[model samples]
Target: MSTVNTTPHTPGPLLRMSDIRKEFPGVRALDRVSLDVAHGSVHALMGENGAGKSTLMKVLSGVHPAGSYTGSVEVDGEPRAFADVAAAERAGIAIIHQELALIPQLSISENVLLGHEETRYGVIDWGATHSRARELLLRIGLDENPALPVSALSIGAQQLVEIAKALAKNVRLLVLDEPTSALNETESERLLELLLDLRDQGVACVLISHKLGEVMRVSDEITILRDGRTVETLTVERDAEGRPSVEEDRVIRGMVGRDLDQRYPEGEGTIGPVRFEVRDWTVDHPTQVGRRVVDGADLDIRTGEVVGLAGLMGAGRTEFAMNLFGRSYGRYVRGSLSRDGEELRVGDVADAIAAGVAYVPEDRKSLGLVLDDDIRHNTTMAALGRISTRGVIDPGLETVEARWMSEHMRVRSHGVDQTVRTLSGGNQQKVVLGKWMFTRPELLILDEPTRGIDVGAKYEIYLIVRRLAAEGACVLLISSELPELLGMCDRVYAMCEGRITGEVAGADADQETLMRLMTRTGEKK
Candidate 1:
């Protein structure tokens, strides 16, 4: 399955940006950046965070008004200036942001037809709006009722809703920003198919994302940006002459301007006695606590081993971890939870942490970090009392510790005083790592540890995991990518429909075997 839109290449340019230069107070966001998009083809713009990609996309979509920067944007060989996003929209450029912009209180149809509402003079034309939304939804393979409130849909569905909204405006150049970050594999596949279909309809697309595999699969051309400058743009084709094909080295060389000998640094670790265990652990479905979502899952982690949990979406991996961590899920959980070879009660988060267990949840916004709070506050969340004295938070002490974490973790930010929401997803993930690292637990659980982080930062996190393992901390990682689990874990527990179906030695495991076990026959998931 591919996540890219494909097309027959024509010898004509659809969109072009020449000598683009923009500056912030302390950062030159883009310098002499030039790019071209062919008609009916997907052009992927790639770079590490703070590499001027976001700035370029904003400029292209007219979020940065004309005359604010020195740049020339031309479409179809004609010079045009976009004064605002509305002007760009009128020019058939529609952008979808990573964080969706639909209103929760509004229906899908309402959100889709928000600014361009169908109206007759002073009267709102609800009938026409609903009809148009229905048509767009059908085109995007969404059969869900368009009248349903957007809040009730999953993140993936809401993303499709965003696409449907964009489709309503008759866009020619569609800019998608990390569109698949929150989607499951199947949902992502479906979305990619939709993009391909759109390209067939003669719509050009510019995808700004960190996922290189997907970028290689769908894009005809890929451009790399680093430190606010345009690097080489690689053309991808089965018959391309004298160039790298689907290998990561060429892309890495362009993105970082350096060769990484090793993506993940290795460290020696000695396995000690079992530190955590769950016996006959079953989670009654969260909605129905007595019904099992995870049934009789038995797994163990040693003192210095990294164990990976791998499965498809809705396979109960996250649910099992949540139930194991703090009994946070399931109305009725019946199981034996143990730590350090001794029975431990984890009725709440406090009890779990007190017993030397820490979990970094997958959904950073809902379960991991508090977005409204600052970095210092989030880092001190799991173990606030340790940094506090006499029940009052010592602000100076907290800052010192947080500062150390920021430096060690290489969190890219001016200071811990900055709001966590303002930071990128990768940085927010680092803050989550700092929170768990500060807890100083024996067993640390990381779910989708490198979900949206760039290549450079992913290597850093991999090294961090290696360091933690070397220091005798048992880490549990849940990830959708099989290669990550195979590369990082010492052992792996494969799950399918709330059961620990298979186990493999990390050294002996392959993606095919793990997937077969995960997709077991006769399992009603």
Candidate 2:
């Protein structure tokens, strides 16, 4: 175990991590990584998906414990060691992970003070709990009632509750990991504003995000990490009017080790006759009676064409996709799905797979892959029959198929036997894509495919999508980013309130034009 010298307090950065080294059984996750976060500033960490950002943060937050890694942590220029998460919290450090830690069934107040509840005579003090939670909520500009269950709030609101939970410990140095990956545009903007407010209050924030525009907007300094080491930390240059002047390409160079001349790859495929079509697709909400989740949505994808679905969070894009695939989401009310001009019946997931249709879900962690399983099992899961004989599996064939998929998908891993849960977010996503692609579908629907991955990984996925289209497959891409839609799709369809509002060629579409159609509730102008 390494030790830090007992240094006296002095004026310096609020937090400093020097020469952090973390290792797993087969990998050195971090190597000599260092970071310094000044007080009253937003320091952004930018990197590729497996670039050791999260590992370094875990060491600092005591999730890895003091003796588990070789590092020296300093607060107020005084060397200190954190034994565990609680010890780090007591030192005014709080971490809000990308996947929120709030309990959905509990009330906001209960979740905020979960471990350190207020007590009166050895009993939980309900009044003090709600009072303190309300104060913290107010500080973050959240106006919701603290007594409401966390499940009743939107994802954006739940994110605010997570911040409130951190504030309950009187956090001075806050760390947020990919905070806006799941949020809509409006929700993401509000959260960015809150971070700026926190900076104004002299709170030191370490923000880990892949959105370059968002980082440039709120970050005072940016640190770039690549392949388990620090590339460099550049101070964000500002113009005379107090606007960020740093080029996004510089950050990209640092992350990927070279300039990314183009973010989305160009496709050479030409569109043909309609290969997949859906008409009058109406689906009712499963839990709510007399309410339609997808209302008479109609669309068609031509062969070798990449189509985009643009909408807000609740526009039923995912529901429509899920229902079309296998009626997996909402209750199917009425719809007609056809392939090659022949009407098809997709009663369940198996039937959908047999009908040459595949869907990659939006929430990959819960609905896509089995985390505990190894890469080989997950890769061949959707198409096990191919590698089996007489209902008996062939281990050699399975290994061969899994290895091919991993190589084709560019999945970074130790081997096919590596557990899927231990891989990084980008690699796990590759496995999910590989599992679906192994089924060899004609019409592939990708929902939020690049939601939380880094730019380098995103570019790789985009190239894969183009390759699939070039191989004469029809693709329906659902994403919240309008730029992504414009960059990749041949045509775009806008959905509003469960209905298809408008359509435009991708070359002719812009953010404003799509936003107008996405918010439309009446006849299109």
Candidate 3:
């Protein structure tokens, strides 16, 4: 018998998606999209708002079943079609969405073992559940007790619990969608480290994030998608000098399909007289008696000036802003607020709006926009009077104003009739800004405005902020990113332990200086 030459078999990619095309009525959301993730490696998906990143992930996760979209998902070189989320989980694939799904009232063990609880005779075995939950928690570096309610934990801890839930399902291919969008700097770093550890343990990871810095730091390979199509997949490349690096400009060009020379829009404007002033602002905890959250904060902003509030997580920035706006949060709020040299009492939300103050909250989905409502309604919700006759809304006028806002904000959508929940995070943020702009406020307070948005969208928002300031609006911007504050604000106030520690001119501000002042407590101007 003649011995035939046999070639050695090579394993295929751990997961491969090819020729994905999804369509809705009058919209082709994804066009021939494709992806390949290697085993034990981190794959990053990059895209702008409404660029079909989430839609593609949904397809992979079986939120849209096999028949709903045209694509081929192969694992271990074998074609697999998932019928639903359960089917996907059966295939060792798990996805953690941006908005957490844990029930606040449930304990950590209960949430982790939900739907997959250990049972004896169809009765849930509480001891077994707690034991497994504890093991999973310890495996993920979470030291908290599993019996504690999820509500008692911080947002960062909640995210770790979410990961533990994924691990509980024995997930081999894990997808994290904007995992750190709501986390502070330290929390985000810790989360990224956990992902890296998971990767080293032979688990594949798919990370979807808008924070370019984090993406660059963690991704082994990056695939940029634009206009619902894959532009290019880039790997870490080295120059002739043999130093490993990836140029941010190269990634930006792939994401936007062009060169973006500037990351922030020009904020050149004339600063006029003081438009708003707050003196001795102090606020006690809403439920805790005699506990102060904001203490003796004195600040002032001029017309057409962008002021930045800088602090670490739990530095009491959000508490101060919420307490100042209509006293919507906290009790025993003692503050003197003035506009144009006239003292105003913001006793309620209605009074705050009437006094020319508008706030765009940080948690836009839950706190800012009505997700289930249509864009037209959300756009004009704040200033219904502008589009209403008497107390009744004029449908035609509402449509006109909504259309105007949609065009002005460049909101990418099927139409104004589309529900806000269906829009991307960036577009939803635009809707919130439009709603507040219609209020015609002389002072605008934006909290963590660009928290989860892409770089391109951030640039657009920066332009809008500058435009508002040029129109003589005093803009108070609160953000955790020091670069954002340095780039956009004319002046920055540092907060530490619920008090204003110090203030720095934007031109003279740096990260080290701001951090020093931010940690300096009990120092007041």
Candidate 4:
């Protein structure tokens, strides 16, 4: 990987936390960990799920507060104790979490200057707020109107706005957690470029991400955490010829605590006869009348087959899946679904579930899970009938079933009663999987299942998908990551402008081939 040349005048140890130790009820979340970020340099923190990476950042950002953890935090060479988020901000530290904290109803200007609004004699100065917000937006290469509602911007643009909000705070140390997890390939590249620009402008950045390629490309230093301790810190080592080199294998070994010879598990199962089929399925935009989002899309998934759906963001893959799953998403939806040559009646979510179909949505927090609920409740939510009699839930039976399902899905939690909101992204995803698995569906539709999760967690999820297919269940996988589709699916259907434009065998699929098909112009009729 080519490295960005950091300015020679970069300052030393812009942010440092030493001997940090944190604990929970029965868990040592962080154990004597430490990190250092130099001004104008990008430092990346990486580890498998449940590792202490996030915990360490939380301590630094004051989410754990001063008395909750034992640590010495120094900002710009001055020792300081941060009691809360406000204190951290006062120390010029800003953290942007994976789940953005922006309010959708507010305008960009309002969201950017949220808590620290420009005021004239104690009254809010709307004009000055918009002016300064625009300047920050321009600094980050985003040229959108500051008056636009934050919800109007695309996901990529919204991410840039978040950084702009941080810049508005005069942040000297910026911490970004999985910033590119939801972005497409092009968007990810642009965001990396922006980070490099920030580094050049003397802002120290701490990036926590599961995408090792991005980490290796953008970071000057990488720290790997495992379990609850520091595993190793890595930098590009130069040889006698003064050429820098980083061993990808060594980084993987550090994060996973062992070497992973293969990233994806091989699926040795055979594809059986067509098990699920959708014919001439069409859906219209929910609010836009007469505008069809999915236009007569026809597709099929065979027993033991893992089929991939590849397309751009608005290509209607999700719309099609939602429409097929009991007409849950769109208006004026028309579809015909059949299993094993027999037509199925799917009028709503209940009917869909009764028909043995399950959908794991792309947005887990908003759709697939109840964040406030415990694993016990979330696990059995989709198939509660199995644990309930005459509308009354059997708590003991539910707990037993939840425990078994959590164990089967390898959900890492204190217990079944642990709130899902507190679990890591990988574990939360496992809970979603368990919820659907409890239903014993013959066909499973997973939409962006591994998004925002670590590499080790992704591998585990892939293994589960393979296991489902091997056991004679049909799996429909939808993802924007081309490599994921190529690695996991048996065949892929390329969608464009609400239609299936092309089909390719997964064994022969490459990024270029898939992209060409996905972006091809004509709609299939």
Using lDDT as the yardstick, the better of models 2 and 4 is 2
lDDT of 4 at 517: 88
Those runs of model 2 whose alpha carbons end farther than 4 Å from true positions after fitting are 1-9
Please give the CA lDDT of all the candidate structures: 0.84, 0.91, 0.89, 0.88
Q: Please report the candidate that would top TM-score against the real structure.
A: 2
Top lDDT model: 2
Model 1 Cα lDDT, one tens digit per residue, 1-525: 112333344366888899999986555779999999999888899887778887888898889989888989987777878999988988778899887899999999999989887898877898888887888888888888878999999888899899888877877889999999989888888878888788877888898878877787778789899978999888887545534365777888788778888776765889888888889888878675356678888889988899999888878898888878888766535888787768998888889899888898888877898899999999998898978898999999999999999888889887888888867777888899999999898888998988877887788888888889889998999999898888888999888888888899998999998998898733532
* Steric clashes per prediction: 1, 0, 0, 0
lDDT score, candidate 2, position 371: 96
Q: If both were scored by lDDT, which would come out higher, candidate 3 or candidate 4?
A: 3
lDDT of 3 by residue, 342-418 (tens): 99989988989999999999999999998999999999988888987879999999998899999999899888999
Best-first order by lDDT: 2, 3, 4, 1
In model 4, which regions exceed 4 Å deviation? 1-11, 237-244
- Could you tell me the lDDT of residue 390 within candidate 3? 77
Per-residue accuracy of model 2 over 349-429 as CA lDDT, tens digit each? 999999999999999999999999999999999888999999999999999999999999999888999999989899999
The regions of model 3 sitting more than 4 angstroms off are 1-10, 237-244
lDDT of 4 by residue, 1-525 (tens): 122333343256887788889999888898888888887789999998889878888888888899998979887777888899888988778899998989999999999989878899999999999998988888888889999999999889999999989887778788999999889888899999999898888888999998878887888889889888888788855577744477777788888878888887899788989999989898998898999899888888999999999999889899988888888999846768999989999889999999999999999999999999999999998988999999999999999999999999999989999999988999999999999999999999999999988888998999999999999999999998888999999999999989998888888889999999899867683
